[model samples]
Target: MYFNNNLKKFMKENEISLNQLANICELSINTLRELKNNPSHNTNLSSLVILAQALDCSIKDLIEDDIATINFEKVAEKNKNNRLFIRQQVFSPENVQYLRNLFLQVGVPCNISSYGRYKTASVKNEYELSSIKVDFNLRVLDLKECTILQIVDFYVSVNQLLLNEAVIKDTLIKAFETYARKLKLNQIHFIIDRDYERQDDQYSNEHSELQAYFTYTLGTESMLFVQNNYERSPFPELEEYQIEWRKTLS
Candidate 1:
């Protein structure tokens, strides 16, 4: 069963109680009790916020594992002599499992081996997701490792006249640039799969083209936080933030 025993473990380590957490999160006592007793249930976003705030951890840290898998195209090319570096979303077991599968499948030829999950000891900036816990580290591929274009998903929405596919893409590019400038992340790229539909012109202003859609990596960390705490919240900004990540890669 999906159990967030990590929550209890963390609480014990921190010497915190449910009552104390409730006060810290401004949540009702019953909510905290529910979390302590049954954390496996589907939690709402606000509830996640409450728990995360109380524990000073990421929402992923408060959850249990989700299922994931990966497919291999070919055997690994590189030998086991090289070191692997990874940066992924915090508290994302699904992604971890996917990477695990991918590494095993690809490493079949080179006899490459994978290292289990470990802590991110070299975090340059704690301000960047400092609250996150239980990050995954895999020693199978180097930062220069490149994978074929498997899939790209684009999450876009044009609620106002300003946001559109072009604008959204541009905003993402700008966000990446900001991160590259601030965090010195020089090598990063993206592949997007977009799903969009046009609404009846009568239903929206002529400028309002599309409704809403989302794109995410199957097993990778998003560029939403390229810089310190500069997250891509209210993401897919359809207006004013016009930048292209593809350009930088090119």
Candidate 2:
């Protein structure tokens, strides 16, 4: 497929120079230039995956034949239908808007809803049905409905921005601290483990920041507090976390 318009669309949308894209995707500037100049020659799966991840999009979006323009009316209609689907689920206002943003990001039209926290989605696209043979593919965890346990171990999806240890430490520590105080619980017992994989080759995956935001949203919710010692965790609070760096469905 031709890469000129598609590549340029993401480049412009992300507002990054060629050099920056090259650096982020691990493709050399010369390679990017060559591809841009010769759009039809040799664009492959690996580079496409890398580029899409760097630009925060799906591979389908990266390899589209042309940049599809967003129609306001169509978007409005889709969102209206989506809102209906969400309302049918009887979720909170924040959860309804969250679903809206999910559809808007992927630009795919879907109308299904599920109930409860940490459950399989009620709707599955064709790709999902025929793709994975695993027992589980997707899940959503609602911090608001989560029980206050002495310790919680959960996984987080990492994005391109979370590359260094310092950044990871600062990011997680701040989130834990904020939510701990807001929830009136000890920081040590909450969010004791963090395991992350890179958010590549997937659509509508939740990341660390989004998870943190979910935790923050539950700040005002009332829950029983259960305290645990730092010994319960693999490492002490505020210490470095173990994050596995690999590409998986984000």
Candidate 3:
């Protein structure tokens, strides 16, 4: 049995109520009540730490003690998909070199650099402001949906902006709009994560804000694909998002 159940047993023996335990643990009353009601519930690391401190027990003592025989399959089965992928485009050789120069100017330490036909480049830079490890990858791909001349990948977090987020976001929006209009891309497709979070339920604040996946149409087939995919999403809310207007390309 897990330590949560053991803890519950201990509490019962001590004649302590969940409300009293909540007060002692400095944990949310709802959280403590839930733990008592469902000892099998998986507590978050933060909550567990607080609870352990209140109980005068180490985390190890509160975790499952029958490690040798505990079945891992049950926990494994509960795990959900946790994949993070972000894709954006940078156009023009000037735009490409501009970013390369920007990073070069920063003089941040990086590891694992490479160059290829798509001109993929990856760098590791720890942000000075937040001291967080930020991995950056830039590349060019034959979007097949946009002109070969106008598609490049901009794969850095928006948080790395030297200026305010609003400024960077506006600049990006203008740049992407210009590229789409110039290339006559009626369809645009992008893959992005909603946000990064310590807990699945937690929001990805400024550290991880993104507009999510987008698709643009260059051809009839691509347009059809975009339409179908849009309708099939669990977040039907995205269907209401407005597409940037494209001026006729000469």
Candidate 4:
């Protein structure tokens, strides 16, 4: 189950606007805005303490349990014997060039080679999705050693060109599900980076750069955050915020 902030309810009971609360708590409005918009967003513990104090409530009262329960055991049993078909093949020069061209059309750049092991699968409408990139690093403990797979990159040039955001999300979920089942793995993870850039001269309009890490269990519809860190980590160059996800294969 997901736990969300009770900021809205607290504010309503106190008859205070976001700005008023921000001023009272000595917090920037942007932080409050993010909290209001994203229910699953992990707010800092300090901020939560401040908010709870200001609202005259316990920290527990400021959090609401609204997520559905997951049955990990049942899911594990369902996928216990599955295995993915992976083959190691070198990509020809012609194939590499073809992939580069396709990614270019979608504002994504890439280099393809035959050096890495690849997993190919079919998505919606029998659309062939080949050369799915898998990263073996960034291992998590929930999955057995050397068994965890991180989908570092995936590209569907055709879908990128033709599908909308909602459809694309569904397709990706389906792709993850297929991989988990075939690979006989319990969990899969995704790391997405959103760049922050200024378009106009106004600095206030700039949004903070963020990284979203997601973990999906096989046969589940929701993407849950298994671990998330907002403070600086060892890899500051990569992201200021870190998120981790873990899904059960059962």
Candidate 5:
């Protein structure tokens, strides 16, 4: 669990400088910087109250729980399909460096991009066998069906140690919600693919046995509010199975 302070966003929106805010809150500049740099740090409640009063916003508006950094890139290639690809990466401060090292060790390329604390991977092969690719394809198809002609091929990938599936899902939901809200999108669509595979010892000991399902969501109120799961074989060529979700923001 992590908490994010929206001090930078609030400062930018209100055109308030760090010095000015410190003065307004009657706090030292070092203290303000500490709070801004580390929201998860254990600090006095009075500091938050003073900052909230100085910023003229509620405490909730300035702080949020389980906030992760998200980054996206628009990918398009004329030689292949005419679909646009939105490559997204999500991570938290604690895992940012770990993800970077993991990606490097896995030989995944980097595009030299950063958003908040997350960085983008340069190669699509990082998520080639993952359900993220399938979900991205589904989201692109959904947009085209909705008459969204300027659809970009969506390619999203994230680098993290294999944690519990539930934790990853929750992190993905929060990241997508932040991205959608950042773009001021009222409606979005996401397709989540969960891949399962097994080696068939009874059938010549081949590693061809596989099953997969997709969870679809057309979100208006919240990203994870409505979901429907369907069983299907979305990708057959991929060997290692991984699950992920992609969103179509409009």
Candidate 6:
């Protein structure tokens, strides 16, 4: 359950900012920031209670009813270890369990050997998710090069998180859903095509920029002070957002 799809809508209607909402709701800015930014991040029911109360709505209004939504993800950064540094830390049994929990929460199946270190000096923490889910009633048909007569599932993969150009979380799930409903279109493809490569100044129309589709990089704490472009996504939270639509260019 993610608030990125719905929280912004409520905030917009109320004409509030994170700081304002934080003061009004008695919820810390940090917690509210996470709720607003990280679609992959979940919060406790108690915080939901405070938020629903402050927003004058129920918990359901905040995180349930996922119909007519746009999904958000982080385009993973490549593991450029460079073999320059061997930073090693032993994964505690509890640490391994926590990781397993996170994977399960994301619906990712992972293989972590509790004792595999003995089998070999090295092991890979690999996970593959093909046939990643798209919103059943996707709100946008923003594909760059592709056209379809009717709604159809576009096959894609969550190839292990790798670096991509840019990222913007889809905080406008409601808006996109409305757009999809009007156009009778479903599914959003995160294509790294010409449209995206082109700078905003290169286009006369801003909508063509593909701001809704996103890619992400691993962010650092120093970036925390950067002003967020809400028009982007409510994500790149875990710093792993990459969705690709493939084709053969002639």
User: Residue 107, candidate 3: how far off, in angstroms?
Assistant: 69
Worst 10 residues of 5 by lDDT: 70-79
- Model with the higher lDDT, candidate 5 or 6: 5
Identify the runs in model 5 with alpha carbons over 4 angstroms from their true place.
42-44, 65-250
Q: Give the TM-scores of the predictions, in the order they appear.
A: 0.26, 0.25, 0.26, 0.28, 0.29, 0.28
| Model 6 poorest ten-residue lDDT run | 70-79
C-alpha lDDT values of all predictions: 0.37, 0.38, 0.42, 0.42, 0.41, 0.37
Model 4 per-residue lDDT tens digits across residues 32-117? 87776764476666778888887778988777653321122223234455332221111223333443454344333444333222
Write down the RMSD of candidate 3 (Cα, Å): 19.7
lDDT of 3 by residue, 87-205 (tens): 22322233344444444444433343434422354555544333123354444344545332222222233333332333332343344445544434444333333332212211223
Instruction: State, as a TM-score between 0 and 1, how close model 6 is to the true structure.
Output: 0.28
Model 5 over residues 1-250: C-alpha lDDT tens digits?
4455667777888898888887888778998887777654655667778888888888877775444331111112221233223222232233344533443443433322223222222223333334321112212121434311111122232222222333334444444454434434433443333322222222211222344332222211223333422122245454143322233444
lDDT score for residue 27 of model 2: 80
CA RMSD, predictions in order: 18.7, 20.5, 19.7, 22.4, 16.4, 23.1
- With candidate 3 superimposed using the best TM-score fit, by how many Å does residue 37's alpha carbon deviate from the native? 2.4
Query: Quick one: best TM-score, which candidate?
Result: 5
Q: What residue runs in model 2 are displaced by over 4 Å at the alpha carbon?
A: 1-5, 66-250
Q: Identify the superior model by lDDT, candidate 2 or candidate 6.
A: 2
On lDDT, who's better, 2 or 4? 4
What's each prediction's clash count? Answer: 12, 0, 9, 8, 7, 14
Give the poorly placed runs of model 3, Cα more than 4 Å off: 1-5, 68-250
Worst 10 residues of 1 by lDDT: 68-77
